[model samples]
Target chain A: MASKTSSDITVIQPPRGWSFPNLREVWDARAILLNFVQRNFNVTYRQTIGGPIYAVYTPFMTMIGYTLLLGVLFGAQEGLSVPYPLFSFCALLVWTLFTNVTQNATTSLTQNTNLIQKIYIPRLVFPLIETCMQLLTFAIAFVVLLLMMVVYAQPFLWQIVWVVFYVAVALVFSLGFGLLFAGFQARFRDMSYLVQTINRLLFFVTPVVYDSTLLPAPFNTLYIYNPMALVIEGMRWAMLNVGEQPALIPTLSAVGVSVALLLVALLVFQRLEPTVADVL
Target chain B: MKPENAIEIDNVSKVYYVAESVTEARGRARVLRNLTSPLRRLRATLAGQSAFGAEIPVKALDEVSFEVPQGKILGLIGKNGSGKSTLLKILSRITAPSSGQVRIRGKVGSLLEVGTGFHQELTGRENIYMNGAVLGMTRADINRHFDDIIGFAGVGAFLDTPVKRYSSGMRVRLAFAVSAFFEPEVLLIDEVLSVGDAEFQKRSLGKISDVSRDGRTVVIVSHNLSAILSHCDLVAWLNKGKLASVGNTAQITSEYLLSSTFESDTLAGEKRFRDFVPSDKYPFELLAMRTYDDQQHVRSSFLNGMPVVVELEFKLGAPKWCTTTPSVRCIGCVGLSRPICSIRDRITSTRSCKFTAKMC
Candidate 1:
């Protein structure tokens, strides 16, 4: 055994801030993060009478609501040659995935305050995994949508592959928004209430409940700036063949904002990362 | 040279500013007005401020520095609010110090409370894994040692039960099991062994002793002098967050005990402590008590085997019999919980008599 001096031992001065700057350390801690995410995923529906059935129940309820409220009451606002039930179902699927994913991701760290305070892990991983877990639930809902479309005898063309692109767009939008708000909420805390209120108002503003194209000109162009608008509109076009292709400008603008928001959120979160523990 | 001193705390100081309640500082008129109504204080507190926010600076730790030589156990002893827990938290990385530096040599496992890292919703079996991982154990390693952990906790029957369902004693048992089962380079414990039944406490101490024997450094923060004396090799006596003394356990403990006893003398004994043992003869007679060193010089401190003197001041003629022997029991010499020892001496005095004897 080699004799050692006090200087030889590395004293980990209490790390400041939230970011795990050490790539090697973060990489080594992957198993721990994975385990934490798995534990949360299990806990969400574990031992409930409904069990994993809620994964089915959530989107099924949304689909039923959309059929009655939008399809029958409003008479299919998008004016697609497609049936009202299929059109409304497609919009509900995309909207549920985006909204639920963002809500769960942004608030994951705040809700698990005890674990965050006691232990140190890659803080970013919490929001990221939260996004993933909710997406897994969304995927279940997506499968239900596919089965419904098949039952209605909608043609399964190669164009159905376009659904993946729409899902990707929604996820990118959520991560961008979720990360920005997660960091903001950690500081101000009031942002959580604001986000919830906005999420409620967002339903009417977006193309989910009623198609945005039904709104008169100028307003439709303006509303597309809301990224979820382009995502939901694109989903309707691709999945239910509704409201034409929605023009390239709106789709391009959605992609631009998602990318820009993601960059800014990552930068801001990294900057405010340290001293999170002290503040919380 | 001995394993590079597992813990080296250099110039670490933690400062907490003490604050006073607003009610205490308010004027006489305000105090009376507040006493007449409780709703106003609640309203004031709800307005995002409180009287307790008024700053009164208290130095919880002041430039305290020490090291636990690798494989050596160190005891931290102090009075209430003397900065023992603050120092331990800084060393264990539970919280950051206001200033200064700390260097830890190896994987440091700390148990500052009975269940500092337990997840209440998790089952006993699951928490063992979660806690082990937090303390730096890999999954495969925990899996390999799972049986050993279950056996040590002795909670095999309830391993699948949620930790919230476990009694406090059961929680400590499982907590100690998970912590003790893991082999880390250094262990930091803070008064957790005081939990659980006496038999389990003994087992926990034995486990700690085994860890010490295995050449892993251990630093224990405790107010129990006997526990420290019996377990630790070196001790640092903290006073007002500074090191008052540091040396072998025997020397530091004896010094601490003597200082405490002297401090206790100034306190007017409590009315509840007024001894009135009705006897056949003279009920009870007060005595002049003086402790001395082995050299027979009048000294305030009596080390182990030194002499203690109890001089009595009494009146001889009374209705009760005068043949009763006076018994003296001095608690808190070792600690407040246990008596050091009791001394019985024959009492015969016209006015008063000074009783001098040796302390074992």
Candidate 2:
């Protein structure tokens, strides 16, 4: 042990306005970040028989439901370039990632009320852990999507590398909304229900079940502004060479909007972080 | 600001704005309030009225200021809801003070509650690492002391088992061991040590002493008087969100004990004479009485073989000479009441008289 010497002093007081979190302190606490992620992963599948296989199974079941509801019932596959299951499953991949990440992240602080009250770790870590945990599930579901694509013999295009960029967009978009809802959820609790309602509404607005081409001109133009629409459509255009490929200008604008939303989300989250424990 | 001081708390206060209706509001009212409060505030804002609504503000800490010198063990003694935990929370940076500030030198390890973030599904080893990380220990640091922690907790045999399987005592021991090894420059401990078996408590206390002796600062908040008396170099007493006293451990502990005894005495008196109504025609009236053990501590029940003392108080109507006799009645397990003993005393003119009787 080192000898007692008062070299560095940490001054604490009530937060007044927006202050950036100590990123260096967070970096130094990488072990805690990893532990949180690991704990969430472990606890999610603790007593389950299927364990992590359920991650893939959930999306697989959802894909079947969407295919039946949107593809067969509505005959929504008339305008798609690939099989209905492949296109819809591709959209479901991004949609599931967005919904799961945002939902988990929104409730992260409230769900860990015991830890929040008892200890001081960077509050951002909770949302980040939730995002990463959902990302892990998305990775598994992505593998399942690839298997389905092979089974359908959908031609894999060279543009598949662009899928990484779309995935990044989806991650940022989800985290941005997650942080926003989390700040309100910490105090309000009703924000979670609001988020769920919005997510359900968002599924219809985005090009998840039906192709964007099925929509009229102005609606098609406006739908890409939702960010997830562009991401899901771009992902399908890249991997399956199906769906209308969003123009470069609109895609770039959506990415810019997502990044801007992420910045705002971070600022709002930081402003609310200090008082989260008090409210809880 | 002094280099020798490890913590400088400057007039720090914490205030919580609580909704008074939260507890009493029924399901529909709660849902309505939750749904429409924001819209109402927005409407009020648009109408140029202040959006802040009515909320009851409770001050948990009131401008409390104290400093802990480097390498000293300071015990914070207070009753429940007396701001001891609030002060510790401010120090740990879990919750910020509403006003003023707290300055601490170097890293802080706060064990506000044992097994704070322990997930029941995780194995003991995993929880140790997770908890150690939460308490601000690096992975390498935990790795270095991993075996020592398991050995100290005596949970090495069950290291791979989930924490939910362990008894509560074993869980507390493991949690304490992980926190004790954190080795931060400043340590804040709440009443976590009061849990677990006596042997573990002793070892945990010894570990605390070892930490302080190694030239680190430790601030401990506990209700256990003996533990505070034995382990602390300085004692700070908090009463109702304010610092009541601060001094040497021995002196402060004795004063705190004396005050607490008086408080409990009054409390017991109130309970004993709650239904006693004084008559306007009497020259004197009995006020209150209670039993006490030999150690100056109040006792509500006495063992059959033990000697007991009964103390009583009476208010005199006028300052006239009076002879008062006090009698005791033993109530058996059945409905029968039997006369036990009686004591007689003659007193000169006085406004009040207090006397004690020893019963064999």
Candidate 3:
């Protein structure tokens, strides 16, 4: 109905499909996203006794416990070439990053109800900002991984660069589920519990604490399709060379699944975006 | 030159679904909710029903439309639940309307909240940048107005101090100052002038009027008629989610003020059901209402200083719940944003099992 054709004129309407927030607009608001990431990173550790060092504490302590039980007590180290702590610690760091980032991403929209209801920043930007916060933690924890590698005299493998690839896949996989569950969580506030329970079950299946090759024959073949297993096995192969190397077909298939989940989750997010302000 | 009109709102409407619980436990809904909650919800979801209850769809805004001409100050006035805020929210794109079209020229900035996303731990300086970005201002824009914002908030000495240490007045002023620097072509203001001290309120009004004079269209929703009358060139009256009237400030405002009284019995052939405000805090529903003079004749208009009795009838939801006393205090006087009086409680008709509150 607007008679003007100047670029300055904007027409607002009852939204059709076009109302789904565009990526370009989200990119244009990158300043706001940076602010969100910076604020969370700065404020989250301010009142803590150990500050941001808490990021590395979880993976380190859990590795010690796993080494005592699985290596020293159970002789679980017999099947591995590298020390149990190094192998499990590498797996734990990747798994920890995924879980921490995923949990924050899942609850991002519900947690910032104030900002969503008042400010006009894109709703999709929140999950991205929250996911970015976990990266700082990963950066801090990666330093510890290097220190432990020096302690055990594990030679720095050129394949160690593949750790970055596995981390990227891990992040993408976590973000996919995070976006998927966030939509459900908005309507049903208890949906986060369901998400955490699923993650706990997945923790066992992904071989975070145990070696992947220990699985029964039929289950070993089926494990190739699991995205988390892909991340953990790929990280173990690249960093420690302690497990069966990730095969090409399985790695490609798992990455494809991660990308597919993200696309599907985006559709779900678009469907629920309009109702967000009302429900919250 | 810019477009003739900065905004074109076409038949805009918004609908909200308000869920109402079907069966609440007698005076102890909390206990029941705590026990059988998740299982009941899962069953309800499986059966395609809401566990809480059925949702009643409410038409928050009907098909009403009005345009703000370029450089004009438009005031949206209505009582609570009249869709004034809904319209503002739609304009700001905080929520999409259910149906209709709104054409706006240039950028749109909404002052829907003061200091939106303000971090308690961040310093006043950091908050200025963060809050500015939250309001859709770019980094360059905040930098351009950095000193002005500090001067306006009067927090120059404490710019590096944490906001948690600032006094409440300082915090509000700081927030208002950041929002006041936003330079969108079409600005939506929703009751933000009521924040801060009286001095800050006056300063905000001045900044808004100054924005209008600079060829920016401003839409302000406020209960303060005096502020609206003094600043607005146009006034729009919304009644029951519909536009009742809109025109020059003097005419529309006067017409709206006369018709908005709760007890307007004199308007013949009009059944204003919205005159009865829904009490969500209590289960009781208002059945009917009547006003009476000292002569025992029905009346809504009264001479100056003459006291009248307002008899309210409500249908009690639970008989046993009437054991507790309920009080009603009429909020906000005619066209004024202050409580004039809480009428004296004269009677409680418990024999009929219907609670009645009478006030002076």
Question: Highest lDDT: which candidate?
Answer: 2
Q: What is the per-residue lDDT of model 3 for residues A100-177, given as tens digits with 9 covering 90 to 100?
A: 777878898899888888867878898899788887788888888888889999888778888888888888888888
CA lDDT of every candidate? 0.69, 0.81, 0.79
Q: Candidate 1: lDDT of B35? A: 55
DockQ-based CAPRI category assigned to the predicted complex of candidate 1? acceptable
Tell me the tens digit of each residue's lDDT in model 1 across B1-360.
234567777787765544444555474556577556646543433232232334455677888777777888899998988888878767765456766788878666677655444677778987887777666678877888889888988899999998889988788889888877766667788888887788888888898999889878899999878889899999999988888988889878888877776666653321122234333345444433444444555555566555565444544345444354444332223334564545555444456555455544
DockQ of 1: 0.28
Segments of candidate 3 deviating more than 4 angstroms:
A1-6, A15-20, B25-53, B262-360
lDDT by residue (tens digit), candidate 2, A1-280: 3335638789999777666677787787677888888888889889999998888776778879978998889888787678888888888888989998889889999988998999988888888888888888888888888888889887778899998999999999899999887976876787799889999999989988887877897896788888998998899889898755789888988899889888888877887787778776
Off by over 4 Å in 1: A1-26, A81-94, A105-110, A116-129, A154-189, A233-280, B1-3, B15-60, B113-124, B158-172, B254-261, B267-284, B294-299, B302-335, B339-360
Write one digit per residue (lDDT tens) for candidate 2, span B1-360.
888889999999888766657455564576576456788754533332233455578889998998999999999998899999999998998988889989999888898998777888999999998888788777888999999999989999999999999998889889888987879899999998887788888989999999999888999999887888789999999999999988799777766765665555546423355336554555555566656677767765433234445555555554234344433332222111222234565554333333454432
* Clashes within 3 Å, all models in order: 11, 0, 4
* CAPRI quality of model 2: acceptable
Off by more than 4 A, model 2: A1-6, B20-52, B263-360
Report the C-alpha displacement of residue A149, candidate 3, in angstroms.
1.2
- Ranked by lDDT from best down, the candidates are 2, 3, 1
* TM-score against truth, every candidate: 0.77, 0.82, 0.80
